[model samples]
Target chain A: MKQSAKLNTVNKWWQYETTASQKWFQFGLKDLYYNRGLILRFTRRDLLASYQQTVIGPFWIFLQPLLTALVYLIVFGRFAKMPTDGIPPILFYLAGSTIWSFFFDSLNGTMYTFISNTHIFNKVYFPRLVVPMSIILTQAVRLGIQLVLFALIYVFYYFIFHTASPSKILLLLPLLVLLTAGFAFGLGLLISIITAKYRDLDNILQFFLRLFMFATPVVYPASIIPDKYQALFWLNPLTPIIETFRAAFVENGKIPYYPLAIAGIEIFFLISLGLLLFKKRELDVMDSI
Target chain B: MRELVLKAENISKYYRLGLIGSSSLKQDLQNLFVKSRDGLTVEDPQHIWALKDVDFELHAGEVIGIVGRNGSGKSTLLKILSRIARPTTGSVRWKGKISSLLEIGTGFHAELTGRENIFLNGQILGLSNAEVKTRFDEIVAFSGIERFLDTPVKRYSSGMYVRLAFSVAAHLRSDILIIDEVLAVGDIEFQLKCIAKMKEISRLDGKAILFVSHDMQTIRNLCTTGIYLEKGRIKLIGDPPKAIAGYLNLDTQLSKHTYSSPHEAPGNSYIKIKRAELENSTIIHFEFWYTAEGNENLSIGIMLYNDLGQCVFDLASAPTRMENGLIKGACTLPENFLNEGQYVLSIAFIGDQSKLLFDFADCLNFNVQDNGKNLRWYGKRVGIVRPEFPIQLLNIDRDGAI
Candidate 1:
């Protein structure tokens, strides 16, 4: 309804006239902020969905990661003699696993948000970004639990092993997290779009993620790779993120420059591409789904 | 005489049919090749048109109902309007901060309490944080879930959950409201609340509303105008009653039949009457046949419920002429049956008693118009039989002259 002619001219559905071209972009940002509420709900759902039936709640969060770190320490670090760059294998492996698990959870979980939330999407209209963004927040809770575990181990390593310092790039830890989330959302969005047409991607994502865990340096240090594959290893943007996380936290406050910047750039590119594809798919995907 | 809020131009939507598998894809590709030589097969390569060339406008203070049978484009239009999905062709234009109450709990967390889900569900519908907080109390109170405010919704009963969700939606102050059949998911009282809330939104706020509902009474009460859709096309658009009548005509809910002879039906169809009588009976069962326009005269059957909860035996009429022709119809039951109760009739069409033909479930309901039998029923209708059962008793005096 037109309360005023000027307001009517600016933006109103009655006239079917969209406002200044620049306003649409601003709407997208505001839409994102508004959708943050659903993201919060989704995050809550994601974090607690697994533990809903359990007697002991989030304690499992700490126990699972701690137990996983222990298993890796015995199997790969002690039994196999895997490399840890002269650091205690437990501390080193926990550092890498802490970041890797968060990224993987977000990437793998978000890959199905579109499909999982289709029931809701078909029934209502909100920004689709709420789904992927929710996964990021949900996984953050899981990662937070793991971080507390990492702190306990860090304390043991510091007073016990006489090592461990807060990374100078700890100030940039927020940026690192953003980069990790951005890459996961970006790639997951791309995969979800393809999934509507070719559903095998769902199966591949589950299979390849486990396989990809072996490929990443979660247990063994990255140094085991020969010089020739160093370039190839960089292709997986996670290589440097996981490696940088390990080096900065465990290697005593040293920041790796080239690898961090490369990961950032790669994450930026993937997100941009993913958004483009996502926007295009939003136009008519309900029919396909 | 208020303000124009929205307009659409030649908007159309397309949908693909069939399952998600290899066979569907193979058919799609085959349809694609066939459509290449033609124009505008865009409505689905399987060659089904979900919506075609729809145009409409809405004033700010309007509550319009869209009614249609299944597969109509009512949902398709709502999807495009809400921006959940897009149209295949044409465009929709509007001016406002649009909000839809399509699905109330789109992303509700089972772990979250009612208080938490208020913000979550509000945001899912495009409401801002300040907007949600402003009306949070009203939402909780409206649902009458004050005690369970802190409890997780997963622990709440489905009715309670629907109440909470609907309450959140009802409290929203939005520019445009697009409500789907989601309200029907709630209980009757809750549905009444939802309809009342929408009425206020449309009348008081002057928010342009596009409502889709199967409940005719609700549609008549809430909507000022209506659009009747048939197979993806706008068949009629006018006053609510007229549009509804036209739509119902196409659907044909109430069926009626009368016959002189069973075998000598209107045509060569072999339709024989299994039973007949309008007398009150318990759970009245009437059977008929299935006949096509030009095929074998199939006998379809119907069962009607009358005053009283008593259920009579099954009456079946089958072995139709097996082609198109007039069908036989009848209703029968034992005598002195019905006691007293409200009732509605059910008619099922089946290949046999086991094989289903068509189930027009609960097609019609009528009042018994009680006769004066209890306490002399002074206030009720005074008659020998409830319906004045077309009978007479006469006394013959000794002398006609006297």
Candidate 2:
């Protein structure tokens, strides 16, 4: 019943040839593309599992950002009297916190890709990229819910005080989000490989993430920093992104083209380096992890 | 006419004993700076080969059962073939998609409901969301947990959890399926169902299957070909019966029964045991072939032992003169002589019916199975031998006129 033609045509064989060292550029993008369903499934699982036992399950997603922004509003706006570039303290802090949390949560989730998913990774073979991608998606979903809260407060502020003004640069919202996600995802990829080898890096990484919040001007505006440190501060890559986010949403401000360009290039380099390390390390990382 | 779906050539894997998964940045730093003699890294002595020079090809619609003892590299070989781990040497070339069920419920989340897990697990095994949706009803029915489909899987008993997991795996459409002792879990009825499903998939889809299990009955029944692995090397590759025989012979309690070359047989110069095997059917036939050169008063003796090392019986053939020629001695164990348990056969060549020339201890291992028709008291039949002796009455003593 079998045909000889089937045997003669041997183009589809997948050769698992174990070489001494694999090529660093072979990112297995084809495999990742094939496993898009798996990525979506993982994201759904993470979102559902995040708030399963909690009361008012999805409310926690918005509550987290609101509470953090409230704390920053009191500490920096009322106590320290930090300048807010003439934007409302609550709106300014909320916008910064919203964008910062998207980057923070995505990076936090993606950095632990190897440790958190050790059980599943040991048993099955999917693109290792799927984990970070899903982490980004899960955080993006939470950000979406938090943005709804931000919108409600912005509308209230606009109707009462006429302070919030939408800018043409607001059209770049999707691109800004992409840049934020890319920054977090790229840095998280590199950290994941590091943590996979040296588990001790986990504690050190947590401390650095907290320190990085202040470095990025999440609770305060960029105008407050002295002019001498301005050039040095813009090198943080996240500086221009946060500043551009605030410029587009709550203030009628000009976009910092030079810093934004610098941030974009930095993000591109980080992503390329992160992917190279990931592709190189993912094959044998299971043995160490 | 079967198509070759998987081929592994000279595959080998090595593991460093104490240092597995302990690689840290500190060690990497040390290795970076520290230099050994001659600028070559030192080979750690703890490195051990889990698999060495393993090679085989799997054809479509063929079920290959891999049998080995614990730590015998069976799982390691499966890991390499499944791409969970890479081989230290050699490579695997395969056509078509390969899906491995290394463990049931590999990615199942405890908090997720059964319905959610079905979709999650299906996609993890390479099914699209639409594909999973199409087979959702069939998967649930196959699992027989439709009543509890919405409950969190963590609340389900372990049995229910595995059933749901296996159901998802069973619906997977792959050209090659790799299974590793998943059927060893679950109850008997479910195990049988799993086996039947595997058979149906392999038959209808012409999928190449690689299975590993400790259960010999399942191997003999489900597998078309068996691979006997001993210490990471293929001991035998043939029909299931032959491979199973070779694997059974590897047991410490019962060792090899045949030494095809007389030079390597269990003997010095006088006599050698070339072959000693039992052929079981309605009658249990044992045959031993040997060669004796110096002794003319060679006699063949055999001792049978149960699994507990208890001697069941000892018998000797009449003394016979022999020269430098091949010799054969045979005996028949009547039906029902052996109980339902493992037995070992030890053959000895004797001189003048007194002096022992060569004694091959525990030469053959075999099992006598129950016919499964016992009306009651199905537990193990008492004793080493359960012989059915003939019984008759000369007369009924009707009116005492015998």
Candidate 3:
């Protein structure tokens, strides 16, 4: 029996076809582009709702990094007697905390993308990538606020103490931010997909992220890592980005070209692998959830 | 030739029961070792087919109703069609953009104001920001929540939330619209208005629709064609009435004369319907033993429904003071109230001011045989109720009629 007849030579027809062994490598760029408005709205919603009902509202965004940096200054610079490579403890820790917080927030937020948004994901079909992408963008806004705060402090120290001066490497600030965001987003996406199936990964993710922060040069200057362990430090994808960011802002800080190049290669691979896994799992992940 | 809007070919889905994560990499490696030793692949016994070999076609402006009992793959089909879930097999091809309201208020954040949520939800449903801005007033007006538009949606009543969500979904300008049972959320008035708007869009705007609903009356009223699914396969397809009848027939076939004991019965702990049988294809006899607990104001009600899922008539015994024991009660229907067709009898226990305690839907099924009163008529009866009304023909002067 002729159950259904295939329409041939259709003009402008959209086909939704799938198979058991389908392979997809293309990032759903078209879907992401079309739903860019959703991404922006989601980002706005996240920003608005994050601090709702709080007494200070968005002041928490700036206050969080400020407080964190102060704690790091007292604990690491004042008590631990860690060397700051001639950079002021406040300046060094503030710069590190600001950049590190962006990476941490983006990674941690996107890491729960599938699990936290299961209700919306199960009911609706937009690009699944939109959720993680929106998460990164939302973190970008917080990063912007934190950067302004950092800039204010840097200017104060620059004129008052006449200690730190900007370098031409500061021109690479955009590239540094991109590298950090790319690495965090990629790892977060990969972890989110894994956690969707194995929920135990979610439990481990927080502990891992905390440990990872210490592994990178978030609390102390990269110059203090000692000469022998420098290579091991650069093994982490975040080390070069954070070191380069500090180099851009602080005098005597160095941007190691070889380490930076290796980090870039690693970022590309991590992001590509993350996208591949995300695209493959997104179709059937809801059922498992 | 009219344009084809969507075509689905041999779609199927399989689901595995039990823990999803237990089948981890370690388990897979163990399975591989076992397979290598045995030289044969072992099948997981916990797997069940949610949908199997389903095929259908929809055209522009066509409305199709999908009907089935729970776990019969109605939701599975909708998920695949909406692209929320991928089919395990087969392919679906379509023309033009498809917008699905599988659920209303899918991504609505409680902290966002109603106005903000509208734009957010609109964009999520595939509308551009400019498009949403242009239709902003109309959406708010349709939702009838203009006074509360600036309030956070968490503060809005559930009805207001559903109304706003539905309004945004209604304005989606896709070529095909997929709706699940979201209309069941709001009040009857809002539901009616949504149905009207959907009808207008399909009829005037020429958009195809695939509606999944358990409300048979709504399906009968709106759908031109229907698909009845049973056990993950299409049991019947074609005209809405015929498909509905076939679906009802499947119910009766499963539950014929009597209900089993409490352990096997399809009821709750408060009541265990022991036996339900139909007599003379007209009178319904049912017996249930209830544990009254402490309340004495318990009454039993039975509703009879036809094949179209419309309740034909209902009968309720007046609330009687009773003790906790095995209580027996039987009721008969009004004579000649039902037409010659299949009917399902559902029994429910009611307490104080008609609060439903337990409802056993489709507990008993019986067929009403035609009494040969319409032997001279060439066709079957056309309605659920067949009552003979006396008619008087008046033929006064036809030529003098002005």
Candidate 4:
């Protein structure tokens, strides 16, 4: 059983060095590329395992947004009389809630990356980013399904009811999805890394995301905000993203390019900061966990 | 010359002892303020080094065994090598891809079928989709759970889970493999098969391996070189037998005869030998505390072994009935049953058709000094046991001798 005889002649070597000044913020794109297959596999597992053994299974993905939109239609549209910028209440709320849910689910899912995967992370070494990335991709798939449902509902409202018109700004829909993902991912990663060390932050995060949902234009039109406080509302990065999404679907809704651009810049900064913190903390977070 | 595949230098890791996460934001703020005001770091007092200044080099085909008692930094060293955790200071370099089997079947979802988990686990271990697909048959065959491949892993028995897990880990293709005590799972046959597979991979593919195990026999059987860690430092490094001997010798020196607390004693909740010792080096003295409701067919087995890890004598008590409570038992080995050498005593509590309630190995150690009785015969005894036997001589007629 001696292994000496099987020795090969290859001399290639890879060296790893640990120092106080070690670059922890390299983004590890190469490592991520190397483990891309694992990311896809994890995404599949998350999608499959989420609804496994349940009767409704994948139907729940569509049903969740649909039901939430219905609740908003009855409560905000009828009871509260919230203005939707003259668009049909169902289409307005459906568009806003479906997009909002995608962002919220992505953020929530990424926030649990460290806590939920601590067991696997503690045992194995792959690109740690793959877990969060998989969460984002899985949420993205759910978003895609919900968007198709939104499209079908939009067609029925436009052609059948003749109450809504598709805007040329709808071309920005893909950009809106990308921005939503970036915003959610950046903020989620930041929170996830903080919670790994401070765990108390996790409790605060749920409360914060829930409260922040009201600030976004998911339930009411952005036009309803008083001009004096519109600046304050736009300070929330999600405002511009949600406003732009709604604007692209309705005739009277206006695309706020300046605020959207500001939000986009903020997202880039947030994600960079998030990645920096995540990279620095990931090395030693397992010891703490 | 064999190619150098891996090298680690001055590796050290420090871990905090108390609560891991911050308690609250208010406390964290206060601590930060206090830390800045005093101009002193507060982290030093709360941290202890799990590993310190460990250095090693491995060639392409070397299978090095890391041996130490628990908490001696053997696992910490492996964690550093495997890239699961970065060392606080120091570096490790290796050739080609490295795969770590820190825990077998890591990330195996219970709801996923055995077939799906095979692909998932394989990818997690750095195997590509095509790679897993090609090796799927071999992995399934090795696990011997082909019939249940379509069944969810949750439905698989613990043994089947371990078999499937180990099979996937064993099939991982990499230039270097780092494993920690995972072979302790599964059946003895599977364990041996894993050891053989490790040897074959190292020989045929020239993969370097760093294996950590508390099982000294496996270390002696499979490793080409050994590293003995003690209190976060490398105590000995070289031959496997020598390192294992050093580790065992260190174990005996640290705790001479008695294991004081239940924590120090090795056993499960069912039974534990609270304290064990030797009296006058001849009559073995030991006491065990057992807690079992309706203790029917309960018996104790004691074995004596020499310093070289060879069993010289083994004896078991007859079945005895007892009530539920803290019960103590003492047994004495017959006189002159062992020769003059360092001996380790192991105990096992067996109940109901020899089912093991608890087993503790190397529980107590004692020395025999061989008083002047065999002075003319030896410098040291040749064998493990010196039993007392009767001898007789008879006269025979010369005519009948032919």
Question: Considering every candidate listed, which one attains the maximal TM-score?
Answer: 3
Model 1 alpha-carbon drift over 4 Å, by segment: A1-27, A44-53, A164-172, A249-256, B20-39, B42-45, B182-192, B250-402
lDDT of 1 at A39: 69
**What tens digits encode model 2's per-residue C-alpha lDDT throughout A126-191?**
778999999999888888888889889988988888876878987777878899999999999999
True contacts kept of each: 0.50, 0.50, 0.66, 0.71
Candidate 4's interface RMSD, please? 2.1
Local error of candidate 1 at residue B238 (angstroms): 1.4
Output the worst ten-in-a-row residue range by lDDT, candidate 1 chain A: A18-27
- Give the poorly placed runs of model 4, Cα more than 4 Å off: A1-13, A18-21, B22-45, B250-277, B280-364, B367-402
Worst 10 residues of 3 chain A by lDDT: A1-10
The regions of model 2 sitting more than 4 angstroms off are A1-21, A249-251, B29-43, B250-340, B343-402
lDDT of 3 by residue, B1-402 (tens): 557889888999888777765457576587578768874234557677899999999998889998876678999899898888888888787867888888998889999899999998998888999999999999999999999998999998888999999999989989989999887889989999989988888888888999988778888988978999988999899998778877786433533345556777656767777777666665566666677666658887777777656678777888887776567666766565568877777788887636677877767787777665644864457777876665799988889966
lDDT by residue (tens digit), candidate 4, B1-402: 789878888888877667776546686687678868873345566667888899999898889999876678988888887777888788776667889999999999999999999999999998998999999999999999999999999999999999999999999978889999998888889899999999999888888998988677789888999998988999999999889877767344322345556667666777766666666665555565576756557888888767655567778988888665456666766676677777767677888746778777666677777754854775666666776665787776657855
Q: Which CAPRI tier for candidate 1?
A: acceptable
Question: Considering DockQ, where higher is better, how would the candidates rank from best to worst?
Answer: 3, 4, 1, 2
Residues A35-137, model 1: lDDT tens digits: 6666676676566567877888778888877788888899998799898876667778787777888888888877776677778788777767777877888
Please write out the lDDT profile of model 1 over residues B202-230, one tens digit for every residue: 88888888888876777789898899888
Instruction: Give the alpha carbon lDDT tens digit for every residue of A169-216 in model 3.
Output: 888888888988999899988998888877776767789889989998
lDDT of 2 at A126: 74
Regarding lDDT, does 1 or 4 come out ahead? Answer: 4
Residue pairs in clash, model 3: none
